[model samples]
Target: MSSSLPLSGRVGIITGGARGIGYAIAKRLLQDGASVCLWDVDETALSEAKASLSSLGNVATAQVNVTDAASVEAAVQTTLAALGKIDLLVNNAGIAGNNAKLWELTPEEWRRVLDINLNGPFLCCRGVVPQMLKNGFGRIVNIASVAGKEGNPNASHYSASKAGVIGLTKSLGKELATSNILVNCITPAVIETDILKQMTQQHVDYMLSKIPMNRFGQKEEAAAMVAWLCSEDCSFTTGAVFDLSGGRATY
Candidate 1:
């Protein structure tokens, strides 16, 4: 590991890391000289990701259910044991959920979205922060969405869940402000990913029309931003929401 590498000697854990933006983030972190543990609920995907990423650097995989505290704790232990110490946490696991009117959504539908998008990050932070505290350094980047800021019609559950993530990032950032554990989030309008399959075409076109750039963001683009956020250079910003909305976010 060259000292010139921004993340040399750092270790990171990326939730939902088997595919999409999470997978891209794992690759970027590895390229930047950080060892990473990829966490996801799909065992097959985890194995495949590790196989593909191992040549880039030291990579580990954990089958995790972020909504469950016990599962998150086990993955934390797995990461620490594999990589020694945790320096960065990217809460990238999430779902767009089913696009529908708020009144049409069932209690289970709403809870499912909230559990994975919001509670997952909370559980991950709860489990990983102690190790970071011991190391006296940490970086937490939650993957929020522009929908959280400007609510999307027929996607109330998704919007509200991401809004909760923004709130979590702010609250946690402040609590650990003095502890050298900087926390922040990214609110992307839309990035090209398989997650789009879960959404309706009408919803997708509506989101695309809002982006002044007239195109969807690529997964690698999101990964590049996250790489910087996880690096030592991102020292001054915490509790902030960085927009990757292609001019869709006004504030």
Candidate 2:
């Protein structure tokens, strides 16, 4: 590891850190010299990810249900006890609910997706913001989606959830701008991650077709943007939306 890495001496909590884009971000942060705690609801995946990432840097795992207040509070306490202080928060835990139009979707399905995608981040922010305030420094990066910018067909719930995330990021960013706790989000186009498994083939093809790049993005690519946002170099920006859309986003 390079001594001059940007994130050296930093510690981060990554929700949904067990797999997909979350896993990639954890690995990147570790490589950048930050100790990371992988927070996930999946104990099995957490074990596997911990084993795989332990060799790279300091790593910890905790089973967390981001949608639950008590669960998030406990995870925060555990991370603080283990890592001592948290410098970064990556709200990467979200689910792609079933693919269906608004009329076709059940209330249960809608709430489930919103609970994890929107409420989860809200809980995490509530849980961790005080710690950041105490330290007088922090970076929060929410993993929003391009779908949030332009709602996708048959994925209304997922799109709405991510849009809420973006709204949360902007509002929080402004509130904390003077406190040095930066809050921002990335709107990435379709990335090739396990979340894709939940989407139908037709939906997948439609997403790909919308990307001007003519391809799905890689998890590593999203991680790279997130890494930069998590670093001190991103100081001037907060309450902002970054585009990782493969030219799919016009605004």
Candidate 3:
């Protein structure tokens, strides 16, 4: 059966696209026929990601630290210069800073996590939204976490950052509601990715035990939701939170 691709002719920028869930989302978007620009902090990983994903379709690579406005702005310009215009944005770049109790966590650690996980998306949006507004169309997907909803005990930093992301999604969605731009977020519980290495074994076990499915989510599963949210098919839904927690989320 012949099927038409919904994202054909679209161009997208995926932050943290070098690996993990971000990598999977890039691959999925490519399969759906969108030209993808992979943005990451690691130049080596970005090169490897671009190489691996090139066979799927048009691909570009950029080194960006999303938390830095200058870095993000430069990347946006580069992406526009290369891809013409950005039609979609996937804010997936984030860090699972050292796991520790709220009291045990240092102020520096908290700021670092917020800078990358929360400030990163804000900066990326600030850089890209102007172009999207000019084009009159865009899709933004911020990858959040179930911890944002539940507030994990030892992961205050991660949880708080994601919660901010959720709040950002809602507010931005409303601001762009009348426009052709759609802003939404996904909250997944414990996806099995290299980011897991950042967490302690005890922390990992705690997260897994909370998942009703008794297992961590797959990167592909999260990627699928992102692909859909970025497509025209996702029209009418903006500033919404799509749950990918595998029965872990109550609401």
Instruction: Report the error of model 1 at residue 220, Å.
Output: 0.9
Total clashing residue pairs per candidate? 0, 0, 0
Q: What is the C-alpha RMSD of each candidate to the true structure, in Å?
A: 0.6, 0.7, 1.4
TM-score of each: 0.99, 0.99, 0.98
lDDT of each: 0.95, 0.96, 0.95
Can you tell me which runs of candidate 3 are displaced by over 4 Å?
1-3
* Ten-residue region with minimum lDDT total, candidate 3: 1-10
lDDT of 3 at 165: 97
TM accuracy, model 2 = 0.99
The whole-model C-alpha lDDT of candidate 2 against the native structure comes to 0.96
Q: Which tens-of-lDDT digit does each residue in 105-208 have in candidate 2?
A: 99999999999999999999999999999999999999999999899999999999999999999999999999999999999999999888999999999999
Alpha-carbon error at 125 in model 2, in Å?
0.5
Identify the runs in model 1 with alpha carbons over 4 angstroms from their true place: none
Candidate 1 scores a C-alpha RMSD against the true structure in Å of: 0.6
